[model samples]
Target: MHLSFKNLFFTIASVFGIFAILILAKPVLIPLAFAFLVAFILFPVCQKFEAWGANKIFAAFLSMLSLFLIIAGGLFLFSTQIIDLSENLTEFKEKILEIFTDLTLFINQNFSFVPELERGELLEKIKSGLSNSVGTLVGQTFSGTAAFFTGLITSIVFTFLILIYRDGLVNALVQFFPENHQDKAHKMFKSVQQVGQQYLFGMFIIVLVLGFTNSIGLLIIGIDNPFLFGFLAAILAIIPYAGTLIGAAIPVLYAFMSYDSLWMPISIALFFWVVQFFESNLLTPKIVGGNLKVNAFTSILSIIVGASVWGVAGMILFLPFSAMLKVVCQEYIELKPLALLIGEKNYTDSEKDDKPGLLKKWGEKIKGWF
Candidate 1:
């Protein structure tokens, strides 16, 4: 294909235009995006039930029921710790005041001069600011939580619809391509579904393992609410790269504030470091790495773009979607370069042929059927 100024202008316009639409339509699109991803994960389960002679409605309901139960059980388990934590809000407030007071004193003694009355006024202002911010944050949190559940409900409904009509939905998508290429499009969709299933299932296992190990480590170090913090960290680990560090920071700082000894914080930090090291080096690379087959740059770029478009939700969803995008792109001549740009580099075709990931095996089966 020849690169032309008009074509370049159109491409740039299309890119920006799509982003504008994504931003404007986010309230609906975000939930729809999530629903599609969840549908992909649950579709195989639906199929399994159908294979066992269950009706599509029953199969979809069963899948959704299982998910709802898992979520409810998790929330139930966390409720006790949440209540305990809520009871300590007074202590947390005091800790914040103490920290602020210490900072003010340090500034007065070491960095600047302040009259006694001025110092008191400054401290009062700081406290008042924090109080207002905290109140605003609390309100925002409640509203955000409500919005989340609403979206979740919407996603569940969409997933059920997608599950029951998966064949028609897929056929609709495949119809977008030319008639001659529709068969290839169908195979690509199969690969996309296969990748989604593998990635999600592998991530579930990784999170459980990480949560168990983190809790055990924290328990050994005598951190309060070890399981709660451990699993919270594990869930945040879904964010990729910096997520582990961000997740670990909460409990480690809490440890510093809660324990009189310095070693408690040190131990919490150390535990997370070890877990992160192993997870980065071993778990992810071994488990879900093959599912994406994307290079570091593309994955990171997708995360950044996703975050910019949809905040944290984008960061979590975009990576796998990029992988799926790559699968579809590889089938089209015009977009194959995009696939090459995102995909892992293999020096030789022989090297790629030598090792087939699970996704490749499934994709091969899909292609075989066509």
Candidate 2:
């Protein structure tokens, strides 16, 4: 009992210490984490370039340049649409006011206990609130853009250096383990790298597939800037389940404001729903495979914890980090339970222990036909 209590205390203390450090050191750690993940995805490409007669530095630069070009091109197009949208903000505000007035009137008529407020007074108050919010938002957006660009440069620099010194980094990490476990350490390193690359590459494919499909659907519905909204949604979809929902909101809001009829926004929502449903069920599994599969509950919890700890970057980073953690846990006897906790049910040892019944296996096979 005493030993168990001691172990419990140590576990709790360790978790808290790690969480505290993550929250406090986020400014530096966020970029480092971004660099690390980017390096994982880009290292193989750099090696390919080097094998083709390029030097390591040049290879790394080429890899970074390729990524920068893709991002810059997308941003250039998206920003153009955003500029157009901003020019018509006054029109959108007017439509919003009309909707708000209707909502207020309905509430006032339906409920007698509620105080009947003057439409002009209510509009004035709402206008003031929105004006303040817009001002704050614009200020934050400009400031944040500068910070984002600065961090992007830092991440690119770190990625290049990491690719150049990756061998040294691997050796240093392996040295942390004892001589007896050095082989296990090397295996762990390979497994983690494989997991990162697979997840990232799979996600990239998913984004392209989603972007193309979403653009087609939006165009069918006659939405403006279909490519911009589609690609933006696809990029944000990297954040897991919540990201799809969040991305869908962007186009839905624009459709709502741009069109006179409510049908456009409704159709956009339905289209996103259908696309997300298939992407989650079919595309993700087929391309990404089950290498990094975590249960939905754990995925959501990790995202929430990540957001709390490091805001947006944490949300993007923690899911892959958790998958890597699970991979490491699976190699060690003491940590196996943790691996089980974070992993998907179908992927866990419990499922392996009790050979799945024939009926269950058949069910899975039949379900896969969809």
Candidate 3:
């Protein structure tokens, strides 16, 4: 047996084993991943502080302080929005009940197999869902307040430690490579830092822009609570494709019920479509760049896999992490094929039979032998 094949099989098994370990150690690793992202974003700022003669610990402390303030401010705004929205619970309930009733009626009218639901029973279900959803999300997902705080504090501490030991971390990673490959390993880490900063900071800018645009559009369309819905949608866009759809769907629904004419809903839908189009092609392209380097299919697949492994954290972290993996792969001759697999570059027919394509021909040859 060729040594190369043995190495390939060992590497594949190692990857599967690592995945199992990740799932088993998720409670610890998830926070660490979050910390790494935070440290990446804060790296430059920490450097400046260090350059000014601040100790690593103090530099990390200052950086973490600013991050905390920004997060607290955002949360405060969200809390206020929720509070104000709660004041309109009665109106929201009526609107929800109306939509539910009409939906049930349509279903019954369209489907012969469906039993018709009375309006009273339909309203009861809708009300129950609305009341329980908030509790379920906040309580069940976080598994109570203690777990949420633990993760938050853990991430913060990890970020500080990462920022403080940023250089040490890089050196530690480089040590894993042979002497001849040490330079490439260092370059890979540098590229990952650049990717992380570009991806995360660009996302922040895009979110702010989307929030403002969504709010202005909703205001023009005369939707109630435009700011609340707009920013909420904008924030949701952080979740990628599904978030944007869900965000727009909320206002579209509100517009459907708020106005007498169908034009209002149509207008809101069209507005989001245009905004999202420009966001993808213009805003994201300009700000985020091709840092992720993966295609849409890979991205959506990562989200599914990430959600399976890490839940919400996976969906948010996996895309960037995949890009990081690609960077690391590109640094190694043996791993370059894996990098190509991870990337989204279009290939000509001639390129299709490249090194990795050997596996395809090998499979076909096996069939001939069979």
Q: Rate the local accuracy (lDDT) of all candidates.
A: 0.82, 0.84, 0.80
| lDDT string, candidate 1, 1-370, tens digits | 7779998999999999999999999989988988988887777677778888999999999988888899899989989988988898789877877777878787887766765635467668888888889988999999999999999888888889989899998999998999998998899888888777777766777899899999899999998888999998999998877588888998998888888999999989988998998987677666666436577888789889999999999999888888888887888899999888887753235353235454445545654332
Q: Return the top candidate by TM-score.
A: 1
Clashing pairs in 2: none
Question: Could you tell me the lDDT of residue 127 within candidate 1?
Answer: 80
TM-score to true structure, per model: 0.89, 0.87, 0.82
lDDT of 3 by residue, 1-370 (tens): 5578887899999989988998999989999999999888788778777788999899889888888899889878778767876887778769878877888777887884557667778778877887889877877776756876999899988998898788898999899989998997788788888667667777778899999999998898887778888988898898878889999998888777667889989988999999999988777755554435566777898889899999988988898888788877887788898777787653324332223222223334643332
Clashes of each: 0, 0, 0
Q: Cα miss at 103, model 2 (Å)? A: 2.6
Give per-residue CA lDDT, model 2, range 201-236, as digits (tens): 778888999999999999899999888889889999
Instruction: Give candidate 3's error at residue 323 in angstroms.
Output: 1.3
- State the lDDT at 246 in candidate 2: 91
Model 3 lowest lDDT segment of ten:
352-361
Q: Using alpha carbons, what is the TM-score of model 2?
A: 0.87
